[model samples]
Target: EAGVAQSPRYKIIEKRQSVAFWCNPISGHATLYWYQQILGQGPKLLIQFQNNGVVDDSQLPKDRFSAERLKGVDSTLKIQPAKLEDSAVYLCASSKGWGQIPGGSGNTIYFGEGSWLTVV
Candidate 1:
């Protein structure tokens, strides 16, 4: 019934410092995704997880970003040694998994307001 949740609606930190963001997807959702959106641009998929296993992380900046989903529910994304380029909003979204149930391209994702991060 409840929608996705994200914490620290806004965060400001110096570059190279570590920061973590948390997300709680909608209940009953079988798929979760983390996205990074810069000002004015479309959201970029950082990672996607189906249950407890990752389905995609091709766009994730592995050198500084890491994420995990345990119990196939809540998820967390951490940025270690943050970079100036990392200044952007972190968005968490959820949808039905195609493996468990069929989904169409028309199936849209719900997004949180996002956790805005600023690097100084």
Candidate 2:
């Protein structure tokens, strides 16, 4: 099966600038997620979508970060007025469904190579 796809693998921008990253998840998957991974830290959940509807976004910084999954297939994440602290790898992941434990039978979450961002 094809893996998740992401674009603009690397980016550098000045603080307070804006940037958007795009993602296309694995075909047929119904759950998509966006995570922010700071250097030396685990990826943190930023938003989640079940098909075209949002499942969770409490961790998202609504004032500056926004995301959308359109038509249940592709997604986009944007950070406006980006801050130096916003520098991190933005990861796109997909799964067949929710409530499936990691490493469990027939349950796997596939991840993209991630879009790397550097705020200067």
Candidate 3:
């Protein structure tokens, strides 16, 4: 039972450059999500994927940020023409279902060691 996996644990780029992050969710998980966390704020959901289709992305910045889950498995998130505000940790998380948490009735989201991004 492995947790989610992410790469390029840290990244730094000048504003206007492009960056991408990758994630591979745990096996048997049915839902995946991408979140953005600025230093002083809690993580904000950027995108949600149920299987290979997008469940929600209303908060995602369409002009520069994009994400996809392939074949209901691996996922990727990209940011182009990066802005200084985009400096944050990109977190990848997954869950089994609504009642899958241990000793709890709610889903337990498992998060990856976030991909840290710094825009200069």
Candidate 4:
């Protein structure tokens, strides 16, 4: 099966610029997620979707970030007017549940090499 796909392995922009990233999850996956990883820190969950419905977006910085899963297949994350602190790796992952998440192979979250964004 094809794994998750991401683009613009790297991006550089000045503070306060708008940028968007795209992701295509694996086929048959029931859940998708977007995470932000700053240099030297663990990835933080930004938004999550169960099909076309958002299941959890608790950590999403709504003030500047927004995302959507239009057709329940692929999704996009947009940062309107990016900030200097937004420089990090945007990662896309997918799992298989909207209910209590299980573990092992079923809960496997495959990462796309990541879209690295730099703000200056």
Candidate 5:
């Protein structure tokens, strides 16, 4: 049972610059999510994907942020012309499926270490 994997653990860039983060969820997981956690707040869902289709993205800032899960196996999140307010930990999480955990009543989401981004 492996855990979610994320890359470029830390990143620092000037405001208005662009950056991207990658995530590989646990094997066999069918749902993936990307979240943004600012310094003092809880993680906020940016987008969610079930397989290769997007489930929800109402919280995402579409003007500068975008994400995609290709083949339902790997996902990538990109921010272009990022703002200083966007500085935060980008968390990637996954679960077996919505209310479909084997022998479990609820779905358990597994998270990665997180990719830290700083927009200076």
Candidate 6:
């Protein structure tokens, strides 16, 4: 079986510039997520998608960050007019179910190599 997350191992962008990241989730997985991890801080959820529908995006910077899941398969995350604070690793993750939910019995989530970005 193939791994849960794949491709787009890294990326770097200048401040105020735009950049995008892509991910291909594992087969049969129903939940996908994008997270941002800055130096010295834990990963923060940027967005969460169930199939092709958005489940969460409250933590995302609406003016600069955006994401979409296509046909319940692949996903893309983009940052426009990125800020210096956006310098970090963009991680793509997936799981069979959302364990974050109460008593959901979700499986262990898997993360990709992550796209690294630097606002310069």
Winner by TM-score:
5
Off by over 4 Å in 4: 101-106
CA lDDT of every candidate: 0.90, 0.95, 0.93, 0.91, 0.95, 0.86
How high is each candidate's TM-score? 0.92, 0.93, 0.92, 0.92, 0.95, 0.89
| Candidate 6 global CA lDDT score | 0.86
Candidate 2: the clashing residue pairs are none
Backbone clashes under 3 angstroms, per model: 0, 0, 0, 0, 0, 0
Query: Alpha-carbon error at 18 in model 5, in Å?
Result: 0.5
Candidate 5 structure quality by residue, lDDT tens digits, 1-120? 789999989999999999999999999999999999999999999999999899999999999999999788999999998999999999999988975657768988899999999999
- lDDT, candidate 2, 1-120, per-residue tens: 899999999999999999999999999999999999999999999999999999999999999999998799999999998999999999999999887566777657899999999999
TM-score of candidate 3 relative to the true fold: 0.92
- When superposed on Cα atoms, how far off is each prediction in RMSD? 2.0, 2.3, 2.4, 2.0, 1.7, 2.2
Error of 5 at 117 (Å): 0.3
| Model 4 lDDT at residue 112 | 82
Q: lDDT tens digits, residues 18-73, model 6?
A: 98888888888899999999989999998999999999999999998999887999
lDDT of 1 by residue, 1-120 (tens): 789999989999999999999999988887899999999999999999988899999999899999999889999999999899999999999886644334546446778779999999
Q: Stretches of candidate 6 above 4 Å error?
A: 99-104
Give lDDT: candidate 4, residue 91: 98
TM-score of structure candidate 6: 0.89
Residue-pair clash count for candidate 5: 0
